[model samples]
Target: MDELARRSFVAAVLGAVFFGGPAVAQNTTAGGVTRVALKGYDPVSYFTDGVPQQGSAEFTFAFDDTTYWFKSAEHRTTFAADPEHYAPQFDGFCAVLLSRGRKVEADPEAWTINNGKLYVFSGKRGVLSFNERPIDIAQRAGENLKQLR
Candidate 1:
């Protein structure tokens, strides 16, 4: 294979092992069972590809950490141009918890998106619990965030 192809192949393998599938390939069954699992925090950070960009209808940060290969400088630049439109809510924390007067970190394994908003949880257990009644959890979370500020 050519050099570029070889490099891409290597990158893809590493990506699957480390970052899981492409950001779009993330699993949302429940219990934060995403491909990767983050340390110091829940697995959702790994599943959602490390939060999303808010505001401008994008999904990634402008200046993403080099840990994940974003594919282009322009992609990063676009994220930088207007981050509020792209940054994930609560830095990829558990949206349910955030709306519920708490600040629980997320596990990348359990994740989902509703109307462009990413919701992450601790793991398969967490995802299943959240899925039992997403609306109620979401509503409570919304009320909780309102009290924060």
Candidate 2:
């Protein structure tokens, strides 16, 4: 890899190790299945409010076998109406890492909205790398996601 690519790879690995692992959308169980998506951050708020807002247990919705919380019932209703629109790309994994063919958990606070789509990052490094070439990274991430599926 080139020097920049090598540095980015290292950053992603370190971020994953220090921060967290790949986030599986589903956290299943025998008693019950409840996986709070985006670490309980209201996905809709990322768009409507332009920031990450902690969700409430009182307003939760289940979609694609994963549970999501909302800051309010209105946000929940908005999400229920059209979930795919508000949901993060790469199933909430770090977008930059996804573009590089890695599955790493993303921090909701380290995120960006591009072309009307929300993309989260492992940290500031990932976000900076993504901002360098968003269209290309997003395209690569989309292709990687398709291959993974």
Candidate 3:
């Protein structure tokens, strides 16, 4: 198999062995009203502040059918200008799990910026796994995301 395909297979096997099965689906919306992205963490903070900051409801914006909270009005404006640039990949789902074709919720605190894009993970393991072979995992995750959509 090619390198990407080989990594994908290994990821799937590891996921099965470690997680015992497919990851649980993430909840997109609460009360079917507002869908909070990044669990209320400001997406912009990952890039600008270099840390995850809890956002205030006072500064919120809706994009791609999800409501994103911001640390400040300026951050909200920045996100509104180009949401795709700020939003986490895999719809805020765990990047490592997505490479394994699983849709799992991500922890905003566990994240990284690769190629100027934001990627969030489920926890420490997810972060470490993604860091190992980011390009391969990201490519695989992108393909899996298309299938999921």
Best by TM-score: 3
Residue by residue across 64-86, what tens digits does model 2's lDDT show? Answer: 44567889877876775666688
Model 1 lDDT per residue over 41-116, tens place: 2212322355432221122221111122233434434433333343344445577677567866666556766555
Off by over 4 Å in 1: 1-74, 81-86
Cα deviation at 2, candidate 3, in Å, is 31
Show the colliding residue pairs in model 3. none
User: For model 3, how does the per-residue alpha-carbon lDDT over 1-149 read when each residue is reduced to its tens digit?
Assistant: 34575455445534543455532112255466566878999999999999999998877665554567888877866775566799998778888999999988788899999889999998978888988999999999999987976
The best candidate in terms of lDDT: 3
TM-score of each: 0.43, 0.73, 0.75
Candidate 3 is scored at a TM of: 0.75
Candidate numbers sorted by lDDT from highest down: 3, 2, 1
RMSDs, each prediction? Answer: 14.5, 13.8, 14.2
In model 2, where do residues sit more than 4 Å from their true spots?
A: 1-33
Better of 2 and 3 by TM-score: 3
Q: Which sections of candidate 3 miss by over 4 Å?
A: 1-33
